[model samples]
Target: MSIQDQEHTAEPSSSPADSAGTRRALRADLLRVGKIGGARSATSSAAVIEGHALIDRRTGVWVPLAERRRQAAAGSPADQARWDRLIEAVTRPTQPTEVSYEKLVVRVGSARDLLRTLADTLPPFVPVAEVAQRIEQRVESGTYPPGAVLAPGRIAADLGLPLQSVHLALSDLAGKGVIEQQANCRARVPGANPFNDRPRQLAQLLRALAAGGAFPPGTALPGRRELCRILVTGDKPFAAALRLLFQEGLLERDVRQRLTVRRGSVKRTDPPKLPAPAGHVKSLRDDEIPEAARRTRAWWNARLSPAPAALDQVIDQLGATAHQLVDRAQPGSVPPSTAQQQLSALVARTAITAAAVHHPHFELRLWHAACLATAVCDLLALLDDLDASRPSRRTAMPPLL
Candidate 1:
C-alpha cells in the first residue's frame, strides 16, 4: 500500500522489519551523524537518512544508501517493520540520547612526558602581578580588537583580581596618555599602557640606601638622566619623585648645577626594639594581625575610591602574600577551575549575623545577606544539576523510537 493508503488502513504504524531493512535504517542514522561534526551537531541536524548512505558517528564513516536500498528491497517483511521505528527516530524530532566522547591525548614518551602531562592537568593560579601584566601585555600587543571597550569591573570579576587594582592600572595608563579614557571611566587603548612597579620600588630602595649611607650627607646625586636609567622611571615621574624627597628636606640642590643629600636626613632603618611589657599588660605582639586577616583588611582598604595612601602599601602586601600563599600550597595541588567559585562558596558558607546586627547601614547589610543567600541557593542548584547529569546519577537510557 502507498504510505497514504497505509495511513488510511486500520493497522499499527510500526512493526518489526526484517533484519536487513533494520540495518539499512541504522546505516542512515549513522551517516547523518558522521556528516556533522559529532553527536552534538548531528542531534541538531536531524539528517539521519540522506539519499545514498548511513553516516557512522563513532568512526566518522558512511555506508552507501544505494546498497541499503537494495538490502531493504530483498529483506523479509519483519525487516521492513524495524525500519519504521528507526526512521521515526532519525527523521522525527526527539530528545537526543546523552553521549560523551572522551579525548585521550596519548604520546609515546618516557618520564619527562609523564611529568609534563601531569603538570598540564593541574589548575593554574592567577596572581595580581600576572593579572596586571597580562592586561598590559594584551593591550600593548594589540590583542584586544580596535574600539573594544575596556571594562575594568568585568575584567576584575573574570580574573578574580581586586577591582581597585584594575581601576588604578587603567587610570595610570590614562594618565600616561597610553590609553584614551572618558570621565565616566570607560577606557580603550590608543597605544599606551602600564609601566612596571619597579620605578616606585626603585625610589623606595634609594631612600633605604640613602639612610644606610650609600649616598652620604652632602653628596651630590648623579644627574637626572643617570637616575632615570637607574630607576627605570621616565624623566618626568623620576623628577617628580625627587621633588617630593627635596620637599621632605631629605635633599637640597643648587639652582644652577646640582642636588645634595641633607646631612641630617639619614636616619635609623627601624625604631629601637621596645622593652618587654610587664606580665598582665598588653603588648604590641598581642595585637599583631594574622596574615589572612591582614590580607582581608587590605582588600577592604584597597577598594576605597579617592585612592588613599594605604592603597599602594596594601597592594604591595597583597602581592607578596599572593606569592607566599602559592609557595605554601603543596606542589602537586590542583587549583580550582575558577577562583570565583571558591570565593562564592566561601561567602555562602560564612555567617554574617553579628556584623549585620551591629552594622551602621543595617539595610545595606541585610541586602548583602540576601544577595549571598540567593547566590548560595543558585550555586547549590547548579551543583545538583551537574551531579544529576553525571553517569552515576543517570538512569537507564531511553529506548530509541
Candidate 2:
C-alpha cells in the first residue's frame, strides 16, 4: 500500500486519553505510599509531650450524659466546686508541642516549669531590718505585753528568720531594758516600760519630796515594791531611780534592809504635781534624762580617772620601794654588801633588757639575759639560808686566839 493510504487507514491510537489515565493512576499510588510511610513513622518514634498531665484524660472510661445530669442535680456547693477543679485539671491547656523539627517531628516546650527549675539556683534574701522593726512595733502595740513570755524559736519560725537572728534581736531588746532574761535564760518583756521614762519621773517626785522635808537624813524610805506599785511602773525604773539616789549620796539601804535618806542629795526644789497623763509631761522636761540615752549620767560619771597623788607622796612611795628592793627581806637573809652587789647587777641587766625591747630580732635575747641574772641573784640569796642551816666546813674556831 502507498504510505499515505497506510497512515490514514491506521486507527487513531488515543495517546492523549491513555496518557491522562496513566498520570491519574501514578498520582493515586504516590498518595497511598505517602500515607503508609506516615503511619510507619508514627508507630516507630514517640512524640515528646510537654503537658503537665502525663496521662490523657480521654483514656479513662467515658461518663454517660444521663449520669452527668444526675450528678449535677444531686451536687451541693462543695461537690460542684470539686467537679469544677476536676474539669479545670482536665481542660487546662499545656504546651505539648510548641516547636516543630523540619515539619516532621515536634519538640516539647516548657512554660513556667523552666522558671521553677531555675528558682533553686537563685540566692535567698531575708528581710532582717524589716523583721526587727515589725517585732519592735509588736512590742509597742502590746501584742507582747509587759512581763509576757517570749519564745525566740517560735517567733523565728513565724517570721521566717534564722534562729540566730531572733536570738540577737532578743539580746538587743534585753540590752535596751525592753525585756529581761529569766533564770531559765528565756527573755521576758520587762514589767517596767522604762521607755515611758519612769526613772526620770521618780527622780522628779523624790526630789520634790526631799525639798518638802519628807526625807530627812536617817529617815526610812518606803519599800521598793511599794514604790513600784505607787508609781504605776515596774522594778527596773524604781531600781534605777533608787540607784541614782544611792550614787548621789541621797539614799542608802542599811544592813537592816531599810532605805535611809542621805544628809544632802536632793536639791530641795519647789514640788510640782505629776502631769495629767500620769508621770510624763506634754513636752518632756529639759532636766529629765532623755529616753534615747538608756544609761544615766551617773553611770557615765563613775568611769573616770582617780585624782593623782601629791608630788611629795609619789616621791615617798618611790623611795620606800627602793629601800624594799635593797633590803632583800624574805626567806633569803644574805649579808647587806652581798645583797647590794646582786641588786646592782640586776639593775644593770634590767636596763639592758629595757633598752633592747624594740630590737629588730623577733626573739628576746636581752630579756632572757635579765631572767638569768635574776635567777643568779635568787640563787645567791638562797645559798645564805642553806649555809646557815648546815654545819660550816671551816676549821673549828681556835679558842679566841
Candidate 3:
C-alpha cells in the first residue's frame, strides 16, 4: 500500500461503531490511571486532567497547578526545583496494565485488648507527689495510725514505683513533720511524746481549768484520785497533769504533798479554752458523765498500775528545770554571762535525762521523757543560734560571739 493509505490504516476509523469503541477504551484507560494515582472519585481525575491540578501523594487531595506554580515562583530556588520535579512526575505518562485487587483483611478486637496491648508497650510513670499523697491519705484516714512504721520496700511494691523514689518521698514527708524518721530507722507516724495520750489530754484540760479560774490562785484543789473521778480521767493521768501544772508554775506542792493552785497565775477574764475533740474531758451531758467515767476507770485498771506515776513525776520535774534554764537564756533579756551559764546548765540537765534511758529502772515513759528533753534542748539551741545571728537590741550584748 501507498504511504497515505498506511497512515490511514494506523489511525482509528471515523465510523459510528468504531468511534464508540475507541471512546470506551480511552475512558477505561483514564479510570485505570485515576485508581493508580490515588484519585478518590471521578471528579478528582477530572480535576487533574481538565482543571490543571495534580493529586497530592501524601494527602490524596488535588492541588491546583496554578497555585503550585505561583508558590514555586515566590519561594526559594530549591523550592522551585522541587516544584519542577513534582510537576514532571505528575505529567509523566504511565503504561496501562492489569489492575490487581488487594484483600485488606482487617481483624477487629475488643477495646480492652487494644488498651492492654498499648499498656504492654508504654511504661508507666509514677510521680513522687503521687506516692506522698497516697501515704498522706492513708494516714489521714487512719489506715496508718500513729506509731505505725512505713517500710520503703513495701511501699515501692504497693505503688509499683522504684525504691529510691519512695525513700525520697519519705524524707520529704519527714522534713514537713508529716512523719518522723531517724538514722537507720524507717519512717513512722508520730505519736504523743514525753507523755501518753491520756496524760497529755489531762494536762491540757487542767491548764484550761486553772486558766479559766475553775481552780483559782492559792485555792487548795481536791485530792488526785477525787479529781480523777470528777474529771472522768484515770489516776495516772490526773497525777501527771498535776505534775505538769506544778512544772508550769500553775500549781504548787505543800509540805504534806497536797496539790494547790499557785498564787497569781489565774487568767479569769477569758472563757475556758477547751482541749481538742480527741481529749477525754469533753463537754458531756449530765447522764453521759457517769458511764464515760466508769469506762475510763475500767480501761485504766485493766491496762496499767499507778507505780510508774512517781517516776514520771521526777522526769517531768527535770523537764521543768530545763524550761527554767531556757527562759533565763532568752536573748536581750539576760546578760551574756548569765545566758551562757543557763545554757550550760540546760545542756547538763538534757544529758542527764538522755542518760536515764540507760538506767536499770528505765521504762517507756522515761524514754519518752528523754526524747522530749532532747527535743527541747535542740529547740533551745536553734533559738540561741537565731539570737546570735540577729542584730542585738541591747548595747551590752553583741550579735556574734
Candidate 4:
C-alpha cells in the first residue's frame, strides 16, 4: 500500500519493512555527508541514532543501544535503569522519531570519539601555527585558483587539503567572525580577518625569500626595509614574527645588513591550542548533576568497596586539613616561616585530594594540574634568581664554604 494508504489503514504503521527503510535512509545520508568531508556532521548523525535507539529500546543510561533496544521492544525493564546519557540524547529532541532522519543523518558517531576528538584536536590546545603555514605554502605554490577571493575550490586545491578540512577550517574562521559567508554560500575574505594579518605578512616574507633564493640553509637575507614591505604588519607584530623565526633558529640575521636560514634546529611557529568541547557531565543541568554525580560517585564507591569506610575517613581528614590551613592563614599578614609552612600545607592538601578523588577519567585533569605545577615552579625559579641578584638580608648567614 502507498504511504498515505498505509497511514489511513492504521495497522501499526511501523512494520519491519518501514523500520528497515528508515534505517537505510539514515545510513545513506550518513555516508553522503562523510564523503563530502563533513565528519562533524557525520558524528552528529551517529549521536542522534545512538540517542534514538536508546529511547526506542527504553533502556537505562550506560546500556548500549543494541541491548537497550532488545529490552525496550520486549517490554522489559531489566536494562532500563542502566540507561545512559546516550539514551537521554536519543529521547531528548522534541521531534518525533518520524522526523529525526535529517538530524540523525547529520550526527552519527560514538560518544567517546566525539568527546575524545574534541578534547584532542579542538583549539586553544591544538596549535594552528602549522596549519596556517600549510595554507601559506599552498597559496604561494599557485595551487589555489587566482581570484580576488579565497574561493573554496581554490582553497582546497591550493592547500592540498580535502574539502571537509577546508569546510571545517572555514567554519571555524567564520565563527570567529573573521570571514563572512556570502549569499551564494561562498566565503568572502573579510577586509580584516584577524587570522589573516600575521599569516599574510609571513606569507609575503616567505615568498620574497623563496623568489630571491635567500631561504636556503646558508643564504643571507636583505635589510629591514627591503623585507618589511614584503611583510604586511606594523612595527610590533612584524618585528615579533621575525624575532620568533630568529628564536626558532629558522632565520639568522647579522648586523651586516642581511639574514639567512639556519642549517639545522630550525623551529617552526606552533599553533594556538583550542579548548576541548564541553563533555557529558559539564553539559548537564544543575538539577541533573546530583543524580549524575551520584552515579559517578556510586561507581567510585563500588571500586573502593575494599576500603569504603577507610576511604571515607581519609576524605574527611583531608577536608579537615584544608579547612585548618585556610583558618590559620592570617588576614593581611605573612610571617616568612608561616608562608613557607602554608605552601607546604597546600601541597600536602593537593596530593591528598588527588588520591581521594580516584577517577578513571581524571588523566586530563592531572595533566593540566601538572602543567600548572610546572608554571609555578618556573615562577619560583625566577623569584630565586631575583633574590640571588640582590644583597642578602644577612650575608654572614649565607657563607656556605
TM-score for candidate 2, please give it: 0.22
TM-score winner between candidates 1 and 3: 3
**lDDT of candidate 1 over 266-373, digit per residue (tens):** 773321111222343331121222442343333322321212233333323322332222222212222343432333222222212111212323222222223223
Superposed Cα RMSD, model 3: 27.7
In the range 1-401, model 4's lDDT, one tens digit per residue, is 32233224433212122444534433433332232213342355554454444333221222243343335422212223223333444333565664354544323343332222222322233123334344444334432212325566555553444454455455555555545667777875545333334544454445333333224346565566645432322456667677767765677765664776665533333111112322321223324323433433333322212123443343333333333222333222223543443343333323323332332223222222222222233223433443454443422221100
Candidate 3, residues 1-401, lDDT tens digits: the string is 32223324433322122434434433432332233322332234332332121122211121243234426344233324434544444332343221111100000111112222212212253445566777777667544557666778766765566675577567667867889997767788888433335566566655555554445467677786656544555576677767777777888877777788777876653321111222222333324333433433332333222234444444444345444434434435344564444444334333333333223322334333433344344435545564765455644333221
Q: How close is candidate 1 to the true structure, as a TM-score?
A: 0.23
What are the per-model numbers of colliding residue pairs? 17, 0, 0, 37
Q: Worst 10-residue stretch by lDDT in candidate 4? A: 392-401
> Local error of candidate 2 at 328, Å?
82
Off by over 4 Å in 2: 1-201, 213-217, 267-401
How high is the lDDT of residue 161 in model 1? 62
- Which structure among the candidates has the greatest TM-score? 3
Worst 10 residues of 1 by lDDT: 102-111
Q: Regarding lDDT, does 2 or 4 come out ahead?
A: 2
Instruction: Identify the candidate with maximal lDDT.
Output: 3
What does candidate 2's lDDT look like per residue over 1-401, in tens digits? 32234334533312122434434433432232122213333433242121111112111111122134226423233223333433333332454353222123211112111112122112242333344565676667654556556788666755666665466567656655767878899987778543335476566556555554444455676687755533334588778888777777778777898987776665543222211232221322222212211121111122111112222222222223222332332324234554434334333322222222223321122222222233233333444454565444433221110
Order of candidate numbers by TM-score, starting with the best: 3, 1, 2, 4
- Superposed by TM-score, candidate 4 places the C-alpha of residue 106 at a distance from the truth, in angstroms, of 9.1
Model 4 misses residue 361 by how many Å? 51
